[model samples]
Target chain A: MTSTTLTPSFDEQYVATRKVATVGRVEISDVTKSYGANTVLRDVSLTIEPGQVVALIGPSGSGKSTLLRAINHLETVDRGSITVDGRYIGYERKGDTLHELREAEILRRRTQVGLVFQNFNLFPHLTAIENIIEAPVAHKRLTRDDARALAEGLLARVGLADKADHYPRQLSGGQQQRVAIARALALSPKVLLFDEPTSALDPELVGEVLDVIRGLARDGTTLVIVTHEIGFAREVADRIVFLDHGEIVEQGTPGQVLRNARHRRTRDFLAKVL
Target chain B: MSRIVAPRSETTAHAAGAATPATDADATTDDTTSASSATADAVAKSGPAGGRLDAGLRVVPVKHWGRWVLSAIVAFVILQFLWSLATNPQWQWDVFAEYFFAPSVINGLWLTLGLTVVAGVAGFVLGAVLAVFRLSKSPLLGAAAWWYIWFFRSVPLVVQILVWYNLGYLYPTLGLGTPFTTDFWIVEFPTTTLISAFAAAAIGLSLHQAAYSAEIIRAGILSVDQGQLEAAGALGLPRSIRFFRITLPQAARAIVPNAFNEIIGLVKGTSVVFIVALPELFYTVQVIYNRNQRVIPLLLVAVVWYALITTVLSIAQYYVERRYARGSVRELPPTPVQRARRWGAEQWNRLGDAHTAAAPPPPAQPEPVVTAAAAASDQYRTGGAA
Candidate 1:
């Protein structure tokens, strides 16, 4: 791989005509969530710098996906707050307190953080290009024509230019995931959250989706991915956070967590998967 | 060696041909004879080492004599039924034809169609609103919708119609005013004037249809995968767009067939309005039959009309189903006309090939070609102006 400068200014030099500079400083503060009796997150707090990639890995029922969902307000926290670029998600700061925003306002903030689900969740009724076009046009950020052109470019970026008109059911699992990646990028979200993006894919197809995510990691966007692909996580993520039983068990550089975990639970968990 | 091989091959072919009973089989006598000749030619061309195993063997299929006999009996029974219809004078074919398109009957038919259209459209719209209400997060709204469906569905349509017709007895005058008080009336009308037989029928039918439609719509909405709505939300689509663009289109796949079924039922259900004397198709026929004492023929006219209306609705349902199947199905089922056309073309090809037994069969539909992958960059970038 070429030694592309890992700087915020790199996008301006390469794809200057396409996008503006991305600002995705994520601040997660003492966030906790629960569903009835099950506590999904317990006082979870993490801050990711702009353009940094963080991979969340844990066993099932861990708070990884819940935490990722909270960033985009897909899952609301029972306590604490999440903000991207210093603006609160799902709420507006009023003096000393946080007030819950209206649905429209929350939705507005949500556009800044795009989510990709494990199942790909591509709209079956829409073609690949149309799926990408739907959000930008609905948000009134671009005209239909502009959205189409943008969609075409995104599809090409994911290597699915010819599959622009294919429905989700018509494409293979790998192609659908790529389209999903393109869809998440369509809004040029400041932050992208991927929840088990490659878990649903066949082994051979995992590389294609990982390749798309790898490309995004280098392009200066804050990404929080919940995945079991530890090798890819190690290569792409600037930091790794491991969770267990609804709490962060360990966090550090991949080498620290994977190679020399400070906690017994983290090491035991890593031993089973590795 | 050629002479010796040809004699043995011919004997085997002859024996195989004689083994089974003669029937309409895939390999006919002409094909068998051609196969023998081809085998002989191959033997002559390549000497003793030429012929493949299983060459020149005509395999006969088992004949289903029982199926043949059963089909003959069914055809005779069907013919008998048709013959009775044609020969029976009690059918009053002449009277049936005369009254079928009479102006009065046609006017009644128009009224029936008008009632169905009005009630169906109103029913579905109200039902959609009720369905949304029931599916809403607020318990108050959900219960209100639930009770509405429950009350309306429990009441018989005929009883509801009667209640509506005699609404004047329950309330002499209806008015818009302060809750539970008439003193602050903004507008008023006599219940008798507002609730005529036609109005009563429309209200009763629409309310009844709406209850069922609500359930159908609700079921359809619920049938859509939850992930679809989450995906739409993640895109930051507005609530209206989420419901209309994402949820409704997918739900329509489940809703269309049942909705159409209700509409067709409404068409037939309009006959119940005859009791109120609002002269729809069935009511008009009843009146005509009572006056002329030609009940059977007039009744037949109504039956045929109802059947015709149902046939049209069924066809529309098929097309509507095909429309919603767009993204889900790989290929849309052919329309009736397309199916007929294809069948005709097939028969034409069969006729052309009847004399040429040696011709190869036409090929099946070709598979869609998958394009080769051109490796995209491993590095992903956001869309321009995303």
Candidate 2:
């Protein structure tokens, strides 16, 4: 496979024209999210490029998933501004004035950015094909024939073409996660957010889910993954971000950070994992 | 022999040291041989001869002395009670037989069944409408639904029945047909009115049933997963389709069981129509007993019929509940042994499948078509914004 070299500054350019760009990257400005007295994220800011793969790695309860959820405005931030592509998601700006967007508008914007949960939250009532087709037909207003065609192609892409009629309960955990990925991809999202995609899988099944995600990276679908798989991060991620206590402690090229870290915390974390 | 005695001391010392080791070896060997022989002996003892003896003994029924005695006492007491009731000089089957097949009583039973059917259908429709309205985004509709439930629930069925029966007194003209009284548009309801005892009973029973049915419908709706709603929303499904397709189907599982109970309740509740002289079961029985003065016998006939109908309804309820319970358990159509077997098989199959199935392949082809469509739509929307 030929290596495609992506400029480190590609993300910045995407964010600069985000408001006007047809496909925009996400820009999170000094966003601090807190629930009452407990601050989950404090003065955290990061920019995700349109087609860059950034992996967020941290121990449990480090606010990695929370930050991802906040990107989609699933969890309202106490004090933060998040812009997806160019549209302000959590906080909306109107005529030089900024306000938090209403729930309906937030949900509408969330469709642009699809979230794949660790638990593979496919609607259990829907079959694998239906799960993939639902968002496109409902949100995109695609006709049944068009939606089915698209859904069939997606199921085939996920290597579950034959299992399109199977329910989530009937599929194994790995298959369910793949179907979920297809469902998320059905929206043709600009940025895909994964929250521990393989954490719930058994040791034997985790590889299948990880392989599907690795393929996503190869396909140049901009991804922000919160994962615990050190090997996958090192292998696929262009940049690895180490988070602690809701703050980015260190971040750099996977080799520089994962293999030869300068920070003590990074070293300690790597030492334990290695 | 003299040489053996002379070496005894040296031999004795060597033997003493080796004795413990020898004893250990002997003990192990003895245990193995004993266990082997014991097993052999047990196998022989429990072989064909013992098996025949056991089989023969099994054919002889073993008596449970305690259970037999207890059962006998219960039978004797039940017999005594039956004899006392049967032999009583005042006991009369004539009165029961007369009332059981009375024309009025049979007519009342028919009326009761008809009223229950009407009220059940009407109440269910009204309750469904009220539930949907209560969940509506419109404040006016929600308030209207709430008020309707509150009014019907708070008012007693008897009061509602009486009020409906006496509605003519409130509006003596009993307006009907059309509004204006002109050559082109003229309609009038006679002062005599059309609301009869049956109508009054239906109105009262349906209104009462509606209140309870509303609650049942609401509970059913709430029992559905929030994901179902979210899925519908994400699909951009129209509100009506979403409710009918996703919401209602999921809610049916919860609704059926409660609705069955309500139907049974409505059937029994029809007896309340006796207030307005509706010839329902209870009222018909009352009329018979009042004339003959065989109160107990006439009442017994009503009780027997009610019990029989209730039993039939209860059986129907069981079947309905079973039908809706499908797919709710881990193992569909689960029996205890079947569930255990399924669980074990699932575990075994999962282990096998995990070892055999390869890692899921990545998307081999670029999803350029979908991505292109999204980009086009985005551009179109952006141009529209411009």
lDDT of each: 0.85, 0.75
TM-score of chain A of 2: 0.89
Best by TM-score: 1
lDDT of 2 by residue, A76-103 (tens): 6777678887797656788888876665
Candidate number of the best lDDT: 1
Per-residue lDDT tens digits for candidate 2, residues B1-386, read 33322233232233233535344333333433453434333323343223233211223455899999999999999999999878875657777877787788888888988999999999999999999889889999999999999999999999999988888787655544455642323454543356787888898899888878988999899988875665455433456666775677668788987898888777778989888988888888888778878888888888877887788887877666665554343335655567799999999999989865564534686578766986999999998656
Which residue segments of model 1 deviate by more than 4 Å? A1-22, B1-69, B343-386
Span of 10 residues, lowest total lDDT, candidate 1 chain B: B370-379
Candidate 2 structure lDDT: 0.75
Pairs clashing within candidate 1: A187-B386, A215-B379, A215-B380, A216-B380
TM-score of chain B of each: 0.75, 0.64
Quote the TM-score that chain A achieves in each candidate: 0.92, 0.89
